[model samples]
Target: MRRCGPAAYPQPIRRCASCADGDRSLRTVTGIFLALGIGAATGLGLTAASVGRGTGAGVLHIGPWLATPKAGTTEADPYARAVTARLGTLPLALADGLALTAEADDGGQRLDGRCTYRVSGQMPPARFWTLGVVGEDYEPAAPAGQRRAFTSYEVLRQADLPIDVVIAATARPGNWLPSGGAAQIRLILRLYDTPIATTISTSTGLPAITRVACS
Candidate 1:
């Protein structure tokens, strides 16, 4: 027989090389799948966060307040529609009325029920207006048998002076609005038959909410 050495084992060596190539191909496929899965999850998470923050396009910023002019109307944006559906609350149309809401004080501090706030400023010109405190769920907040809302007709205003309304869990002296022991509070200022809706580019003269104290 001819002298056969390493060449006699050529078949075994070829089989090992094929096995290595197969393993590398499987690893590459697995890595691609993992990358795709991670990308999809990250995209979904960001979308949910944006919706929760309510930071949508075409929002009207009046001082420290925010409003969607097209909300609850035939021209409502997708974000406005989502918000209405989620909150299950009716929003006034631009023609009939406008609703402005604030979740933070004038100083950009988040409104907390444990803290007291003083809302004071020149009232926007309107036929009728109402200011109310509501919980996160948009329901009226009545704490300790206190009222949740105050109307422009009822709030005491001094001539040539701005209106002042106090928001607290306890009783306040003038224009008292209760927080109802809620962890978070939202101030809704609704203006009915207001010219402000027509001239949104101009300053709305909306009131400011200032934090006074926290217990």
Candidate 2:
């Protein structure tokens, strides 16, 4: 009878091969999971960045301030609509009003609650206007029972001068809006029954924000 030396170890050899295949399969599964994890993390990061960026294809920039003229109308881009929906706030239609927001000063520095700012300049003609510090998502960021917002009638502007408003954690004379000691702030201006939503390109009168001091 043949010794069958090599074949005698057939069982062990087959086991070894099986083990090798199992290892490779495990590695493949791990690689697939890693790829999926990386893709998910990247996607989430992009979405978060897009939300706070406050921008869309129809963005309007005046100095460091920015606005989306069609953000509230049916003409709003997909990104704008998604953002508003996520914020759970309803935007007025173009026929009703135009809205603008500024998160930075004219010098292009992000507005800090620790610092004081002055918003001044000529504004477009509107039947009514309101200015105030809103939350990151444009929600009212004031203490309940306190001043929730400011309207054109509420601001005390200097006669014979352009509109000037002070934003600070502390109070100051003339058109003052408290910053509420938050880390960051955003300014929103709404113009009711204004043509600037469609005529911004030719509208020269716009507001400017100037950083005054910091704590």
The candidate scoring highest on TM-score is 1
Candidate 1 lDDT score at position 141: 76
For 1-215, candidate 2 gives per-residue lDDT tens digits of 86867668745524578899999999999999999999999988886677567654566667776777777877888777766777677787888888777888989898887789888888788889998787665666666665656887777766646788888888787677888767788888889999776777623568889999998
Write down the TM-score for model 1: 0.80
**What lDDT does the true structure give each of the candidates?**
0.82, 0.78
| Runs off by more than 4 Å, candidate 1 | 1-40
Tens digit per residue, CA lDDT, model 1, 97-117: 888888888888888988999
Total residue pair clashes for candidate 1:
0
User: Model 2: residues >4 Å from true position, as ranges?
Assistant: 1-37, 158-160, 201-204
TM per prediction = 0.80, 0.79
